[model samples]
Target: MSPKKATEAPLTRYRQTFSGKGSFGEYLDVSRRFGKDKEWGVRINTELLNGNTAINSNDMEAQGIFANIDHRDKKSNTNLLVGYRHLNIEGGARWFSLKAAAIGKEITKVPSAPEASKNYGFDGLAKESEGYIIALNHEQKMNADWKWFLNAGMNSNKLQRNIIGASSNFVIINDKGDVSNNLMSTQTVTKNYYAQLGINGNIKTGAVNHDVTLALDKAWHSIEGAKNMYNNGSMGSVSGNIYSGLQGNNVWYPSIETGLSSKDQYWGISLADTVKYKKAQLLLGVHKHNASVDSYNKITGRVTQTVGSDALCPTYGFVYQPDEHTSLYASHSENFDKGTIVASKYANAGEVLNPAKTKQNEIGFKYANAGFLTSLGIFNIKQANNIDVYKGSDMYLQQDGEQEYQGIELSVNGKLADKWNFMGGLMYLDATQNKTQNGTNDGKTVNGAAKWNAVAVLEYNPDEKFSIVGRAMYTGKADIYNEQLQTPSYMTYDLGVNYKTAFNKTPVTLTAMCYNLTDKNYWTAYGNNLILSSPRTLMLSATFDI
Candidate 1:
C-alpha cells in the first residue's frame, strides 16, 4: 500500500459477517455494502435467549437493523445512519422462601420439596419495547490548521409492561409497608422520545492546539401504568408457621386517593474545551441540566404533584507527558443524574426524585513500552445526599449525608511475551459513610462496599489457530443492610479455549468455557435481598464467518 492509502485505510468501509451459538442464545450479525461508490451500507443482527443456569428461566428475543450513508472523502465529509430495534423479555422469577432456622430465620433457595417456585407473581410477566434511531454527522477540514464537526440524533421508543397469572404465598415487604399478595396481573405502557445535537472543532496554533465542543439534548417521556394485587383462590394470614401457607385471600388493586399517570421532561447543554501543547494539556467542561415531572391524577383530571430542578456542573483536568512513553494526569469531574422512579414496592412508588450528584478527583501516571501498558491511580468520589428508597420512609433524609469512596487502582495489559498476552487490575477502596447523619451510623463502612477487588486474565497461543486462556477474580468482605448483615469475601477462576479452522473453505471457530471452576457458593450483590453468585457451569460456543 502507498503512504496515503495506508493512512486512509482506517477510514475505509469493509464488509463483515458472523454467526454464533451458545448456552445463552444464538445470534447472527452481518454488514455489507451496496450502492454506487459503496456509499450506502446496511447492518443486521438478531439474538434469542432461552436458557439461564440459575434455575430461573430466561426467555427473550432481540433484533436490530441499521443503514448508513457515507461521504468521507468529500470536501465536506458526512455520514448518516438510521436504525430500528425490538426487544422482548419474559420469565425469571426465582423467589426466595422464608424459613425458620435453629438459630434464627433464613431465606432458602428455590425449592423442589413443595415442588414449585412461588415467586412468579401474576404469572408470565413480560416487558416488550420497540425503538428507532436516526443520526447525522458532518465534518469539514477547511485547512491544515482547522477542522470542525457536527452530530445530531433522535431516538424514540414504545414499551409494554405485561402481567398475567397468579403465584402462591405472595408477600413483598420493603421500606414500604407490608404488601401481601398485592402484585397481581396487570399491564402498563410507556413512550419516550429523545434528541441531541453537538458541534466540535479544533484549531492549531504555532506550537499548540485548541479544541472545543458544545452539545444540547432533550427527552420527553410518559407512562400509563398500574400495579395489580389479587388474592389466590383463598388468601388469609400465615398461622405463624412459614412452613404452612395461607389458605384464603382477597385480591384487589390499591386505589390512590386519585388515579395518577407519570410524565417527565428533561433538557441539558454542555460545553468543553481543551488546550494541548508539546508536553502538556489542559481541559475544562461544564453542563447545565434541568428536569421536571408531573403526576397527573386521571380521576380528577388535575395534576397532583409537580417536581423539578436545575443544576450546573463543571470538570477540569491536566496532563503532562514527560516523554513519548509516559504521562502524568490529574482530574476533577462531576456527575449529574435525574434519578430513577421508585418501584411499586416503595411508599413513594412511581414518585419522581430530585437529581443525584457526585464529584470525583483523581491523579494517575501511566507507562507504555513496545506492546505493553501499565497504570496506577488513586481517587476519591463524594456523592451528594443520595436517595435509596429501600432504606428509609417516603423520603430518605441524611443531611450532610455523605458517603465517600477513596481507592487505589492498578492495571496492566498487552503482550507479556512472544506467544503470551495478559490483562488485569487490582483495586482497593476504603468506602465510608461519614459526617452524613447522626453519630449512630456515622463512620460506618458502607454496605456492599467491597474493600478489595482484583481480576487477572492470561492467554497463550502456541499457533495461529489455537489459544488457551485463564482468569481469576477476588473480592473482599462487605456490609449489608446498614451493616446489619455481612458478606464474606470470595474468589473464583475460569478457564477457556478457542480453536480456528477452515471448513469447506469457510472459517469456523469453537470456544469452550468453564466458569467458577471451584463451584463455590457465594453472595454476589446485596440489595433488598441476597443475590447469589452463579455456580460452576460449563458453556460451549461456535462461530462461523462467511
Candidate 2:
C-alpha cells in the first residue's frame, strides 16, 4: 500500500474470534468501515457466552448467546445508524449462606458480638431472563460551527426466578442478598424506552474561545413481578437452646400472592458552555430533570399513588494553566437522581422515594510532561437522602437521611525509564451520616465506605517480542454497618505476560495472567453472609490475526 493510500481506508471490514475451552466458542462480525468521509454498510455480530470461563461467580452458571445487526451511513459530516440486538440469558442460580460469626468477634466484623452466636443464613435461587433492543441514531452537521445528534432506543425484557431450597432458620436469596424465609419463588419482567437529542459546537470571538452543548432526554420504564410467601414456622428449642427462627415445618407451601408492579417516566435537559482566554478556562453547565412514578394494584385494577419530582443541577469549574507543564483547577458539581423502587428490606418497600440530590466541591493541581503525568485533588461531598413522604394507600412508608464525605486523591502515570512504565493512585475518604430519623444513625460511618485505598501497576516491554506486567491493589478497612460491623483491609497483586510471534505467516499473540498473585483472602461483603475475594488463579489465551 502506498504511504498516502494507507492513510485513506476502506468502508467495509470483517473480523472473527475463535476460542477453545474444552468445547469451542466463537465471535464473528462483518461491517462497513467508518473510515471515509462518505460510507454506508451493514454489519452483523454474534457471540456465545459461558459465564464460568469469564470469571468466578457465586450465583449463576450462565450459558447464553447474543447477536446484533447495524446499518451505518456517513455523508460528509453527517452520520446515521440503525441497529437491533437480542439477548437470552438462562441459568441455574446458586444458593448462599452466612453465619453470625462472620459479623462479630475478634475474627469477625464487630468487636462486641460473641463468636458462634446463633448462625442463620438463606439459600436456593435461580433466574432466567431475555431481552431485545431496537435503536436509531442520527447526527447532522447543521453548520460550520454547530453539530447535532439524536439517539433513541426501545427495550423489552422478561425475567423469572425460582426460589427452591430447604426452609431453614435462614435460606439464601441469591449471592447478593437474603430475604425473610417468608419469601417465595418470584418472577418479574420490565420494559423501557429512552431517547436523547443534543446539539454541540464551538465558536471564537476575539481573544475568547467558547464551546457549548444543549440536550434533551426522555425515558419510560415499567415493571411487574409475581411473588410468593412462605408461612408456618414452628419455633422449637433443643438441648436447652432456643432455636426459634424462620425454620419451617416444610409442610405449609407458600401461596402466590398479589405481585407488585410500578411505572415511571423521566424527562431531562442540559445546557453547558466552556470558555477559554489565554491561560484561563472556565466551564458552566445546568441540568433540569423531572420524573414521575405510579404504583399499580393488579387486584384493584387501578394506579394507586404517584410520586413526582423536578430538580435543577448546576456545575462550574475553572482552570489556570500558567505553562504547558502545570495546571490548577477547581470545580463544583451537583447530582440529582430519581429514587428506585424500595427494596424488600426497607421499612418502606414498594414506595417510590422522592429524588436524591448531591453536591461536590473539588480542587486539584496537575503536572504533565512528555512521558509522565501526576495529579492531586481534594473533594467534599454532601448528599440529601431521597425526600420521602407518605403516599396514600401504599404498602411502604417514608425514610430519609443526610450524609457527607470528604476525601483526597493522588494519581501518577508515566514511563519510569526507557522500557518500563508504571501507574498508581491513592485515596482516603471520610464518610459519615450527618442526620437521620430520630438521630439514631447520626454521625455514624456509612455502610460500604472505605477509609483509604491505593493501587499500582508496572509494565516492562523490551522490543515487543515479549512483555511482562505486575500490578498491586489495596483496599483499606471498611464499615459494613456503622461501627457495628467492620472489615479489615487487604492487598492483592497480579502478574501478566504477553508474547508475539507468527502463525502461518500471520501475526499471533500469546497471553497469560495470574490474578490475586499472593492469594490474599479477605472479606469482600459483610452482608448477612460473608463473601471472600477470589484466590490466586491463572488464565491463558491466544489470539491470531486472520
**What TM-score fits each model?**
0.77, 0.77
Regions of model 2 farther than 4 Å from truth: 1-25, 29-31, 34-38, 41-45, 51-124, 162-184, 227-260, 298-301, 344-347, 385-398, 526-530
Residue 89 of model 2 has an lDDT of: 27
- For residues 1-546, write the lDDT of model 2, one tens digit per residue: 000111123322222222222212344434444435424344454444433322222222323333333333442232233333333322222222233333343233222211111222223333456666666666787777888988787777765443433221233222223333333344567788889999989989999999999999999998775543332232211111112222322323343444557888999999999999999999999999999988776455477778888899999999999999999999999987676676433335566666688899999999999899999999999986433232321223344587789999999999999889999999999988777888877887766678899999999999869899999988887775446656677788999999888878877677788787765655553332334354465666666655
Candidate 1 steric clashes? 11
* Candidate 1 weakest lDDT stretch, 10 residues: 1-10
The parts of candidate 1 lying over 4 Å away from their true place are: 1-24, 34-36, 51-71, 76-91, 94-190, 227-260, 298-301, 385-400, 435-439
